[model samples]
Target: MSETILEELFIKRSQQKRKASPLNYKERWFVLTQDKLSYYDYDLNKAKRKSLRGFVELEKIKCVETVQPEPNSPPERSYAFQVIYDEGPLYVFAKNDATRGEWIKKLKEKVRFNKDLIQKYHPCFWADGMWQCCQQQVKEAVGCKVLEHKNGVGFSSKNSSRRRPSRKPLPPTPEEEKPGCRPLPPQPPEEPSHSVGMTVIAEYGYTPVTPQDLELRKDEEYTILEMTDANWWKARDNTGREGYIPSNYVVNAGNGLERFDWYCKNMNRSQAENLLRTENKDGGFLVRDSSKAGKYTVSVFTKGGGESSGNSRHYNICTTQQGQFYLAEKHYFNSIPDLINYHQHNAAGMVSRLKYMVSNRAQPPSTAGLGYGIWEIDPLHLKTIRELGNGQFGVVKYGTWMGQHDVAIKMIKEGSMSEDDFIEEAKIMMKLRHENLVQLYGVCTKQRPIYIVTEFLCNGCLLTYLREGQTQHPTTIQLLEMCKDVTEGMAYLESQQYIHRDLAARNCLVDANGTVKVTDFGLSRYVLDDEYTSSAGSKFPIRWSPPEVLLFCRFSSKSDVWAYGVLMWEVYTMGSLPYQRLNNTEIADQVPRGLRLYRPQLANERIYSIMNRCWHDKPDERPTFQELVVIVQDLLYELQ
Candidate 1:
């Protein structure tokens, strides 16, 4: 055999051996493609190939025209070959550093092999979906065009162009009857009366009725009617026996429905509705009021259905005394009746509750002096200050501090309570201090109301900065640095055994120089404090909070780490809402079930790896704020 052939065989053998070795390479070249590019070890020269018994560790072949890996895949560890030729596409090795004689020989071999496979296997491109599935489809089918699906890759061709099935139309029913029943002969709709009647009605097993049979379903069924809405409905097959139907399918035959008794007795639905409207829109009924502004009930009811014969669900609504309705769990009213009653029955408690919510609902400041602070705010400042945002608490004003400095004044009308939540919040804030944390300048309690004084960030929030232009212009380095700042501040807090509880870009203020100042200690708590264990939307920033925090209502340094990961996501996406597409329960379920967001534009291998670590399903598995600081710092350095 020729010396060249012997040398070639030795090189090939060495390359094969290197594939199984765990040695690190200085750098690896990655080629751009229409499909994702994976790697396998190979040699393009006989000299290094024959000299070494393992891979030549193709180094120095970096800085390509375009190179992109999968969104959340491991870092590229091997080299890629980009062939340049006039002939039909082939995988001939480029003679980057090797001589023509050596390089051409290997290139020709690779080209020949690639050409042979071209009839069957095509080179993969970094497209919308997974790398492996695209290859599998290419191998199995003749005509394939890569398409991205939510979960993974979808390969399609002209042959697979059938239209999708259309949704079936809902069966017609009487307007007054259950929604899914068979249609009955057209009849005039009956007006329901509130008067109690001696007429007896019989109750029967579950029966499907149509809109046309509304009168029949009401008169023929049980006298005790169940009221529910159709728009916000959930369907279930009662223990496999009761037929499946939407929750709103059942309507009250009369006002005799007593399911809402528990809800009304405990909480003021008007107040609950106001609270729900301030934050969430998922559950609640809007009740019109002539004497008051508006009333809403947090209570959502499920009619008695399925196997449970005597089951009915009632929800409590919340609102402000000023007629603003909020929605809350019916239990929130029943369990914390004193708290609810105090806010509703007394004017002072109501005012104090509003006092803490000055900065933002997602980020209310720690109130040290309670409602007295709002009273201390100078009337001159209030007159000159412009209103920015309004909430149940009060209005956020852009005004001057000390009559000169540009600051924001948050004023709350004093309520009836002495100092319950305000005192606790104040104590928590007094213990926390960090460069990235917003400074609490002072409290004002000299006037008729109370107000809080804090250093006003000119840049507003990270949310506003990202929202100004057609598209956000934040640099990757800036985002990484912000992540580091957040972690650094959070690490200090974590060390002191305090949980920020709510960590989001909206809660963070950005200075003119781009420094991030974490604000809002209203929802924060001490690490070991066992005062509250309830999981309400108010207590937790549902979008930014971790699954453990929502499900267990338990927090630790790990919970803060989870919030930090969400904050990182918010920064990368230019202040997009976390879990924006998912519902509260969905957010809670997915995080613990390992579902997380992966942004393609900002998710480099290292950054994604860090995000994944912080977003682990297990709270214990999440890194500490200290560890997060290290990872973000390292990432910033790499980008620089």
Candidate 2:
């Protein structure tokens, strides 16, 4: 070895399989030095010389290149490469493309720098110890005689060409490489197809397609051209525009207007009026054009039911305000179809009748407030007792409402946010009602410093409770019970398709009975799907965030599950900060490299296993909140 002090550039802890047997793989810490690369069993305390697995001298290397997967090799090793040297080849696998590229680049640089030091380079072969191109059986075989070169001697161009004949064919010509140039694979025998007429119930509004395709729109009758797949129906629209539309967006024309059971986009103004009149004989209903470019609304009208009845008594199908479409001087809606949909369900109140109906059927009892319960609180009735705590946008105060009810009043700081934004957040909170969720009493929007009143939790934040309980030393059953409470609440939220983006022990509250209640919807979002992507430059809690959330700003229920795992760790460790030793930047760097927090001192093996499952690198692999609830409940029962 030369006296040069080789700097350690990169290090990754991974596993390496024995060349002789693919099944035999061992954990190794791969260290990449400037002059050489080696592997050793990882040590927590100090490096051990005896634990060295293997090393390849960079100077003796001839070439480094990525290799194709072998017939029987595991898929994980598909990105593997080989370091060909005079003695033999060093086979190694990387986790992904980027890592593999880095390894190859560094190794090739080293080989190029020490090109003169190479002796006789061996032909690529799968022999005594490893797999290669030139398959040989001898255990002690040296360089092949066919392409042997003297010490540091380069092969002549003529001899090199003769010894190594080009086996690969020439590249394809431009004409041959054009799109759809290759012959298509043989298709399976076609199945019998049925043709039918479908009414576009939902908007299949134009999505930009290839220049040859035409755009499809709502309410347009289409003849079924073909059934492309289970989810898509190939159809020719009334205008002779043929394309695929979502199967759910259309219904059979024979199903009739009753099949829609709500707003009919195709229904004309006269048709809507006649339908509403037939449905509710004497009851007044409103119909108006919809805010959407070509849509309408139908809403049921309740005489003298506006604000006096504690309900708007006006239900529309569409929610977005596009501009008022008037049915009468005093009655109007955003769209005419909305008005008809409201009449079909006979739903009342200011909220969208469609959402209201869905909530009544699909949601649990607590979340029935899908935009219905909102009231104005008299400021004089709320007596401020004391300041509870300050938040990002306001100060929460312990207060009494209506002289008797104790509440936490979140008073927004003047100019902190627009009144419309605050009202919108309050409306979302009002629709949520669960035993494990904080109850919103009402909002005092009429006053200057707006107040949002919610039920007060006696035990304060869960984080504070856990930290205080540390001295008392809660048992495993008690901690597991707390975790179960949080999981159950989160499960409900998940079922509602709600993502608690800021889920953490600090955001949760503990009641007098020691039950954990999920609170702080500051970052919560209601998404139709499991994932929600934040706009660029949004702030996030780094410590509790999953890898995807931290990296791509993509949030989902699974990311919340990841945070819940951290919260469970907080409970077991008595509210200690997660990744306490690493700062945000370090966490962002280390976590993607497979570093994770160790199990808390008090966490049992099973509990840690559940937490580990929650931290799976792939979001889909993480357990759902419902699953977590069951697992924790089982653990709690066992602890009892």
Candidate 3:
């Protein structure tokens, strides 16, 4: 390749000699180069001891005290070559001398490119002689003590891996046998480390959970908790009172058991907003015009579902050019409980609660069975929905599902995700279902490029709504209600054993009736019920992230709580950006340093107390979403 690489090889060789252990011993030789591209080799043992005796005796040659000693001071050494240029340090591993010498003349005359010689010279971990002879030969020939070596020859570990396959047939590829470029064949006998487990997790609680700590260790028996991201509502114990703890930290008491999701009600409304106005570069108010807010109202529902004929009234609080207030249907709440009930009844042969039913239980429809009805779609025709947003992954288009219903279609970018990642996302979505949580529909992989379909909220994201100004000035009661809604969603998700890697206001949607729905599980992570450290970071966006997420990239639901604390600031400011005083890097730096944004507007005694706890430096110190829900609900009711 380049001469620079070759020169570096020699330097590397010299460095190796210096680093070699056991300082005193015989058989030591060094290649030294002077200016003029000529080099010299000195065998320390062979040199006349007398010639070096005087200099050695004085032990002062390295300093300026030498009145130059003669015979003994200057040791006899063999010349290898002289350096041509004084360009760099005349150190070992320099280029081979180019001086006109016997060896040089012969090398220039018969330059037959030798592949065998190159292989011999090349560094390898498992070559013959364990690279010792090759290393010595190169050192002597080059007359430069380069340090770096690819000493792979004769490595026992390399030999053990090439055993014959006993089970699965080969993939029918000859080139796969190549030594250097071969992929390690799958071997079941090796160990269980190669196996991967798939799982899904939900979000909940005040403290955010993280995925890095969820690795299942083969050594220890792990118990899978029923609730992924659960919460416990109680009073703080500081005054000997029970306090709320996010259900995530509650591990299974029994070993090797899988836990189930915990069910709870009356989730808190005082919740953290996920959007970070300061961090998002492309952020702006899309709902600036109040009068034009009602133009779009899109809803998605499964085909043949009842309750469809009405043009559901929608409302928008966006600012408009004409300053006219037009209300459009922000959301459509269709009932699927009946169909769910029908399926469950057929499968289990029991009239169970329709709300908790699934379609798999339904057997082939019988003549006497109740049939599922179509609510409002014209199956004969197809229609396109509105475009919601765009990002690096792909564009988000609202599309019609089955018929009259609409859904958000997240067209993933080509090359942005691999099949493995998609599978992982799918595994997480299958088990997570909650009112506050975003619902993931079936994926469209029938085509070459796959797209993810999800429930579409008629009203735009909370980010847009907040920018339009408050529909009603958030009285203590209203703020508490919002917080409760958020906590309820988080608590549900957390109990399901999931970590919402990215939590922001932009992901939360509100209907015209003020009903809130959390969306976007693309960054969700499952916390395996085991003792393992989870790495957390703002892999997607850095501004809204907590300190540990930025530095160590490790987080638990506790870290999520830190982010929630910042979100609390956003909600109180009527959607003010967190850490508005600092830049992105500054905010990121401050987070790990245990610095958090303090908002004066949200300094109400109750709200401030909770936000402070949420942003605690020690993740364990953060309040659980369930506890937060209880506190907010109490505050709201008191104000009411």
Candidate 2 vs 3: which has more TM-score: 2
lDDT of 3 by residue, 138-226 (tens): 22121111112112122232333533323333222212023543222211122112111212122222221122123221122223322
TM accuracy, model 3: 0.40
Sorted on TM-score, best first, the list reads 2, 3, 1
Q: What is the C-alpha RMSD of each candidate to the true structure, in Å?
A: 28.1, 26.9, 29.8
lDDT of residue 381 for candidate 2: 79
Q: Which stretches of candidate 3 lie over 4 Å from their true place?
A: 1-382, 522-540, 600-603
Error in Å for residue 543 of model 1: 1.9
* lDDT tens readout by residue for model 1, 31-91: 2222212223334553222222222211111111111222463333112232222121122
Top model number, lDDT: 2
Q: Where in model 2 is the C-alpha error above 4 Å?
A: 1-374, 415-419, 522-538
After TM-score superposition, the amount by which residue 550's alpha carbon in candidate 1 deviates from its true location, in angstroms, is 2.4
Candidate order by lDDT, highest to lowest?
A: 2, 1, 3
- The alpha-carbon deviation from the true structure for residue 618 of candidate 3, after best TM-score superposition, in angstroms, is 0.5
lDDT of 2 by residue, 278-302 (tens): 4432344443333222334554423
